[model samples]
Target chain A: MSVVIEAHNISKRFFLGERNQRAFFEDVSVKTIRGLRRLARRRLAPEQSSSRDFWALKDISFQISQGQTLAIIGENGAGKSTLLKILSRITQPTTGTVKVYGRLASLLEVGTGFHPEFSGRDNIFLNGAMLGLSRKDVRKRFDRIVEFSGLAKFIDVPVKNYSSGMYVRLAFSVAAHLNPEIVILDEVLAVGDTVFQKKCFDRMEEIIDEGHAAILVSHGMAHIRRMCQICLWLKNGRIKMLGPTDEVASCYEKATTHEVVAHYEKQTAEQHGPTHPSAIAGLVQWSVQSKAASAPHSIIVSQAKVTFRFEIELTAMISHGKISVSVADAQGLILFTQQGELGQITRGKFWATLELPFLPLKPGEYIVTCTISEADHPVAFLRATPELTVLKDESLAQSGYHGVLNMPARLSVEQIPQA
Target chain B: MAQTSSAKETRVQSVPEIVTGTNDALPSAKPTYVVDADKILSSHPKDLWAYRELYLLLVKRDFVAVYKQTVLGPLWFFVQPFLASLVFIVVFSQIARLPTTDLPPLVYYMSGIIVWTYFSNSLSQVASTFLSSGTIFRKIYFPRLIVPFSQISMNFLNFIGQLLVLFGVIACYKLSGHRIELSLKILALPLVLADMALLALGLGCIIAAATVKYRDLNIVVGYTLNLWMYGSLVIYPRSAVPAHLQPLLALNPMASFVESFRSCLFDTEHTTVQPAVIATLMTIVIAIIGIWCFAKAEGTFTDSI
Candidate 1:
């Protein structure tokens, strides 16, 4: 396949603060006055202005051949939008160059040039022209675009009166029907209802199958895995990783989960601030451990025996205290729960452990919570440190595993023979 | 093309040498784009040609959309200059007793105002290209020139409407026993209008580029146009100015166009070929500088905006 896009060492720098808003003439005059002052003082030191510099992207380079789908994945403010803008030629990079070999249409934003005052039909032509399609081309694809948007009845109505969803559908429909050899999409797929999203996915798949090159920026890891062949993970304006979609997506997902867990830990600590460190009686420390994993926060094998341990420091003794352990997924849905009675406990620093013979959970992030209650009222709530990550067992590593469950089951080959 | 390449070499130090020097590898006859920090000149003029359809559509959209929802619609175009001219007749001719040439006061003030309105409208519209089109410019990439070009086109349509009204006023004056000269020199109206457009586009481009960073230019532009109209011989004929101030007034780029317009329609004064020639030359020079500044700004204006 011939290379359709080639970018070399692209870097973008922006001035931060009030200086960016200064007029060109004002900036020039001020600089000249500053230089005169320096000359009058005969100072040799370099002049430093008040404005700070921010590099939105730094030394980024990549290439995409025909028929290749490249996905860019990163957290917010990770310079993903900046890169797309540069590639689409909406903005120039501070340094470096990009060469595009064919007709390129970038849908960085749907309804980009749509005028709300104009009817849907008029906006279709306007948007098409903005996307580099001629009037004749728009005329040819006019019916198909309207049909795809399913707004045939409202084609002659002004878009401002249409619902937001209808507006997006029409804008996206015009872009989807364009016959550009290279396309750049920036989170435009995460729009409309599920049915409409499915149509967009099918349209994009068809475009890729027709041997067109594409660059996509999306937060959906599943979409990236399903649609893209190559992935570029950006962190702090630099390429963190670049390789096959499965490899890079998995790494990005892990890093993101770790960040999420760290954030959650910080929030929980803050919520527990006034009640912690000086509390007369509460759970002080907790850890999740499994024999199949080295790290206390991770489980490396499927169906591993796991232990949820907690340490309690109480000023008074209790006779009817209860300890409960619950395992929850990332969405905070409690997947498993068990309670145990603590018979007559006089606590200084008492260790409590809840052991599971087998943990029937998939290879993903999960939070284990422990609660200590007396007389049906909870006194302390503790979450395991570092969260829990269930790594896939290499022996059972198959691509078919779906959803968040790894329950052990046996398949019987004795089939029911019905004539 | 040769001039552009040479200009690229002499200026724009950061511009890279063409990366795809040869097109042997391209499988089809598709256009290629080379985007760089300083790649300012190449392919834009061609892209403008290729996007002519878009240009026409934009002009149509702007032209239609301006009056699309108005009750009076395009009738406002004719009413605007007519009313403005009536106000000038009251303030300048009737109250201040400014000397109107041999032409009727209505004809004189209306003609000058029509031409000035066209010039100012084009200038201001083109000047605000970035501010007005910043939304579309940020989201999509097209030949940015198409926007300003379309704006001037729409303004031209507006000018045509007011021009027809001017002619009607002139004809009415002719029927009412006024010996207003309808000279053959009127044939030069198209060239005069084109010259005025070039001047507007050129000046607008420079201001648009400047205002991207210093929005104060926008306010300056508003009042500067008012001051500029006073300087131009729009309200009064060139002869009405003190002889010593005539040279200073002639320094205004628009003086000759207004003078030529009056001479062409009513022969109020014989317009010398020299001023028109000099003004046209100045317009071309200003236009070149304006286009250069605009091209440089388009690459990075989105960042500032």
Candidate 2:
């Protein structure tokens, strides 16, 4: 289990002020003026120029040994890509060191350096050279590369006429056939169709089986969980957690949902001000409350009892009215829908409450909406809450089910002798 | 080593027997690389050696891709210099009454045009190395010098094409019985071309490096190269310049190479050894500085661009 990559205290700094999008002449004039002003103020304000320094990555360190897969997970702008760039040696870290013990290949972009005017055969050689393969290496693997891409029939045609699927297939085929000791991949799996995706995954598995190490930066948690043995979670350019894949992945998922909930809270606070005025005919205001509230309007998983309260103001007499409360996942996929008949009311304000004996949901972010209808026509729809965040119940840790439901089922085990 | 057993258990157990044999052989010796922020300004000769094949392929690509789908194709190489020399013969040799150094005006103008074309084209092409291929440079990692080297080599092939046309013109002049002396100094033509190439590469490297930050250099370089041709003794021979301006003409490094190349064909020596030696030394110094600037910018240009 010899180490293949060892990154030590890797920190990268960037200056935000260096990005100049002005015209050439304007840039010259403005930069000169600013330079003179800065020189004049040099003694008084020494920190004005240094304020533009941005630390994209801060004190990040990790190591991967032979035959290991490491997954990097983070939200956008969490320095995941920067760390990959440093590891790939495409960019240098400002204040750290990295050591590699074997041949390293980085696939930061697919079909990089591919000229659209060049035929597929010529591009194969060109791209292979760009990826660090010698001419002899490419010539030896030429047949296998074309065969894997399934473009042998069209190898002489220019890639500009290639369908996007064929283009990605050709690019991925060359990358997969690279026989390097260590491979760095950045979200390259989310390409092509599902069948090809599976093929790519299989090839990746084979690469690892051949005693190669890989470091992957991907936003797909499913892919990370299935392929990576270790996970590194980044938060604001620092390591939030690093450990076994399952533990770090689950922690990252939980924190991500919490952030989603906070985002929803902020949006609702801005979109709907302090007043809750009924804009529809029937439904006025509706709210959800749980006995075990982790935060304001949040429910703990396995809450046993949950309540949905609604205020309805009917302007005219309504016949055959119905009200329903539905719980949906973050993506608006309805998980549970329950309907109750509304009592006949004429021209007045009334309160209706629906109580459930037990609500079973996994720890995540969800939405609760209340709908009021008459004669099978939906009249008024109201969001019951900003967002429903189901907190984790420590007792459910032993249950090894991964879904939106936490079913209440009894388990019994007994030892029996084999005959 | 506590995680070693767990790591082994998680790896695929069904690896073929031959794959395991390779694993046993790997730990014996392996290459290790250390990366840090401080990159050397000098080019890595070993890395350049490893990528020599890529350099060749790039040159081939440049050669093959340029003439594709053209009307005359490779003949355009000959047509370009011939056309330019025709204009020079009309303006300088015929109207301005410039001396042809006891040689045919076609041969005199053609030789200077081809040699100057080689030097200037190489300089401009190599100067735009980073600007034209910033996309490729940002995405891929290779020996950066390969680009400048490949540009120079590609222009060399173009030089050869135009040289053949010059030779044909000389043969036609000889068939017509003009007193043109063919000397062994023509063997030194390759050395003259090499000197010009070193000079172009050095200047191109510096300009390419500067243009990464101050892109104004790209625009300025195009016009400057055009103006630079007149300063050299391309259209007029060195013997045509006044004695007071003779030293000024020698100050331009390209003047010697162009004069030397013309002398190689006409059997006349107009440039002295001192100017040639001085030009060579200047080319060497400029080349060293150019490579230094190019290597310095190669490591961090992506951030600025």
Candidate 3:
């Protein structure tokens, strides 16, 4: 298939600055002062300074084939709108190049190119022609456009009087009806209510079915997954990942999760150092003991024995210390916490064992954090080590226990005869 | 067409297959960076030609909508200037005793008002083009120049309508035993109107560009036009200025334009040829600057607006 749109290393830079009042005044004064001084200075001066440049899009490159839909998914400020503007030719790129093979119609913003003083009918033709449709084409599709907009009665009225929803509906109808070879939409589906948004998505599907290319920039991952076969995840103005929708989305989710974990680690690192006078400093190690040496890294609830060993370094160890062990779910809801009494505490190395008659947690992941404190002052703390995982038991299938937690209950039912 | 279709199909298949298989297998086409300035410039004229029908639709809209709900309808085009000329003739000529440059006071003031009306109307409307057309400009991709161009054309139609009324007054004055000499140099009236339109458009483009970002230009434009009218000798003759202020007065381009227009229409002898040349040069210079500013602003005005 032929590539309908190709953007190569496209970067857009915008410079923002206050007007140079001093330079302007000095230049004006120099022009007035006259003679050979201005001539000599002009010959000697280097180029003038521009203010500061902000990179809205930094080296973004992608290509779209004809009849293919490429979905761009990113958080706000990810340069989606900037890329669309460059593609639409509404703005020029500061660097790099974008080549579009055929006619491009961009619905970057709804109700663009609408003259409010003109009647809706006039604006339809005006906006249609602006989108690259000829007058005859607009005339040919005139009735269908108005019908789609559901504004047949209001077509002759000025658009300034249109309700916001009616205005967007009419504007979108004109854009879709114009039928340019490449369509670029930027979050315009968020306009109108749910029913109208569905109508728009249906229309977009129809347009795609007709074998024209489209680039959809949307925040809704579900929408992208549904409508687009290919997805590009943008991070900080560059393509983070681009490929199949599911793969790219999963990668994006993983990267976001890692970011959150990194942030949490940074926040917790400053509070605590070490609890006891062990050789290793600030290290709490927990491992599950199994006959199989290559058992999966995470601890399961059905494990034979779980050992939590705390190794801490003491700056100056004098007296009593207690170690608290807490198990929490993913949402940081503590299911349980156990405090080893002072008699159980040794100088450096601390070992604790908790035995369960039956594993309490069903099937899910959980975290275990250890806090070591002396008289309520936290001396050392460590978050989850070998993050816990619980697997579903096939053996328990007959018992009717089907979830993450197993609660034993007995019930007796008595049937009453109904007439 | 068949080749395009099959090629498009093949391209579509290739993209997903290559992407799904391996990223390294994709075609190695880097972006092109030739920067075709001619292509950009030609896009404007091409769009104008392609969108000609829309331009006519806009012109039709300008004509009908201006007089649509008014009581007098299109007749007000003639009624407005006729009444205004009569008032100017009475107030500025008879009451204020302003000097008329070798022509009847009514004919002289009416000629100036006729040309002044076209320039002022075009100037006022052109200044508002950015704000007025902001809605349309933001949504679609057309040459931004079209709005102001269409505005000037619409005002041109109104000026021609009012010109007929001026001709009737001139004919009536001729029949009333006053010798109204007809000069062949009156053929130059179109040139004067063209110059006025260009000058107005250039100034309007500058004002429109400024108004998009500053917003204060809108207010400044309204008041500036009023002050501008007094300086242009619209109500009185250019010769009425004191000799010392003549050079400064001559610097106002509209003064020379109006004076030159009156000379052509009324066979007046006191024509400021030097000032007219300066005014024409100024107009051209302003137009070039305006176009350059507009081209630079076009890229980012969407964001600012």
DockQ of the candidate models in sequence = 0.30, 0.24, 0.20
Docking class of 3: incorrect
- Cα lDDT computed for each candidate against the true fold: 0.79, 0.76, 0.69
Ranking 1 against 2 by lDDT, winner: 1
| lDDT of each residue in B192-264, candidate 2, tens digit only | 8999999999999999998878777889988898899887878887878899988787678998888888876
Scored by DockQ, the top model is: 1
Model 3 chain B poorest 10 in a row by lDDT:
B5-14
Native contacts retained per candidate? 0.53, 0.40, 0.26
Model 3 lDDT tens row, A247-309? 675455434433444445555554544423222235555664433224554444443345544
Of 1 and 2, the candidate ahead on TM-score is: 1
**Candidate 1 local lDDT, A191-252, one digit each (tens):** 69999988987887776666478888887766677778888877778777777777776666
- Which lDDT value does model 2 have at B154? 94
lDDT of 2 by residue, A1-419 (tens): 76777788888777766435554565578668778888887543332325656777888877777887899887777788888877766677777888788888877778877878789998888889888899889989999999988899999999989999999899988887888889887776446888888787777667656647888888777667777888887766767677777777766665554455445545644555543213434566766677676667677677458887777776666677787887876545589899988756567788878797777887666777676676876655566545677767775654443555887767789999899
The stretch of ten residues in a row with the least summed lDDT in candidate 2 chain B is: B13-22
Please give me the total number of clashing residue pairs in predicted model 3: 8
Give model 2's TM-score for chain A to 2 decimal places: 0.67
